[model samples]
Target: MADILSILLSDSFWAAALRIATPLIFGVLGALLCERSGVLNLGIEGIFVAGAMTGWLAVWMGAPLWLGVLAAALAGAGFGLIHAILTVPLGLSQHVSGLGVTMLATSVAYFTYRTALPDVTSPPRITPFQPLDIPLLSDLPFVGPVLFQQTALTWLALGCVFLVWYVLNRMSLGVALRAVGDNPDAVDAQGLSVYGLRIGAVMAGSALMALGGAFLTMSAFDAFFFGMVNGRGWICIALVIFASWRPGKALLGALLFGAFDAFQVRLQTEVGAMVPGQVFLMAPYILSIIALVVAARGADYPRALLTPWFKGQR
Candidate 1:
């Protein structure tokens, strides 16, 4: 009890929790946006891989960091566009389309990596983003260490949460997007293009998903590796439901999972021999599943989700 309490109360724990949640924040927000617009992007896993690879590769090949980020976003958007075209206008199975996209994107990224480095056994590393010194904030006690000692990418993820919330709640564009998701016929009746809104949302949402991958390579670590995404994309899909499609709640869910993961790491260090290491690894996921089941009970999902919306169809 004392050891666990000490870990929970430590500033470093919270800092690590936030850092671990950074990629999730971006991923959940992306999934939320896609679902809001009536699209389910199971391709998120592949997009994450592609983003991490492309972003890191760009930086390694002499492009600037931000440009590498752009390359990642663009790569994600391209894959997203493929999924959108297949499902939105074509009215295909959203599940099949999304899964296809995952395979396609993953294959492309892996192929590119192997093609680029035919003989290299080790993945190359790039210069990652350094933590910003937030002046006075960096010097504060617990609060400073917890909130201010993160890379710019972490802050960017936080900012994106606010931006997504605002756009979804406060803007007219958000209104249409939500409407399109709930009832595309209604949105189309109001002179809005249902196809356009859904496609655009998927593309934009996918861009955000890729950014999550970028964070892995550009902020969390300097090198990209196979399996580095480690199912974070799938977790995001569930977290969106756990969040009930709300940005603020989505952030909380991500953070909670982050804390669980961070705590498990500490717990492993404290009693690695007593318990199997795999149990510690599974703790956060098991806890998250419980939370998801509880929160998802009353989750009011988009009405038109998974329903094909063909423009002009009565």
Candidate 2:
């Protein structure tokens, strides 16, 4: 136990944990945005895989890494548009529509990555962006390297915490979004375009989710694999509930889950017999369950959640 604690103190542990948490952080933030706007995006997992496949395909095609990222974002936006068409325009169930999108994305990634390009592999799985070292801070004794030295996407994810906080808590657009989520009919009565705003929210949310996926394939893993997204998407869904739909709180949730996941790997490496590796791997889910219970005890979910908003109809 003492050795494990010591290992936890090392810069490598923190860096690895942060790297693992990056995608989840992005997905959680994206989920926060959509859920706060009264749109449920369950296709995060599928979108994530799609982004990975899309970005990887772009890189394999000799395009610049930034271009690959752009492709991933576009792919995500495309999925978001489909979500708006199904849920907002067609008045379909949010969960069903999101699930359908996820299924479609999974299929796209599969048939494309596995079926189409199995023979042509290139670039040797190296990510485009390199980790940046903050001049003074990165050289600090222990905490510096862990906190200051990270890939560009890690810094971007951290910045997004504050950015999302400002957007959701301090902006008029945010207030409007919250209003729509809480009471879509009331917002509609105010002469606001509910469908348009919700559509924007969905597209924005999907774009963020897609970026998270790209980060995994490009910066984190540097390659694409079938079902490579693991369950980060589902984990982000739980994070929204745990954070009570708040962006800042979602960061803390992402860290907690990230640490748990990190610890699980280390535990399995050191003491694989005492606790079944599977049980240790379940830590994130178990923590998510506990967090959900605590959060729901006093949660204030959007009033319009899962409720369809029809123009001029209460």
Find the candidate with the highest TM-score and give its number. Answer: 1
* Candidate 1 C-alpha lDDT tens digits along 1-314: 99999999999999999999999999999999999999999999999989989999999899999999999999999999998999999989989988888888888888998898888878788899998879999999998999988998899999999999999999999999999899999999999999999999999999999999999999999987878988889889989999999999999999998998999898899899999889987776677678779877798999999998886778
Give the distance in Å from residue 305's predicted Cα in candidate 1 to where it truly belongs: 0.4
Query: What TM-score against the true fold does each predicted structure earn?
Result: 0.98, 0.93
What are the lDDT figures for the candidates, one per model?
0.91, 0.84
Alpha carbon lDDT at 143, candidate 1 = 86
Q: Pick the candidate with the highest lDDT.
A: 1
Model 2: number of backbone collisions: 0
Instruction: For candidate 2, write residues 21-104 as lDDT tens digits.
Output: 899888998888888888899989999999888887898778888898889989998998898778886789999999999999
**What ranges in model 1 sit over 4 Å off?**
none
User: How high is the lDDT of residue 296 in model 2?
Assistant: 81
What is the Cα-based lDDT of residue 112 in candidate 1? Answer: 91
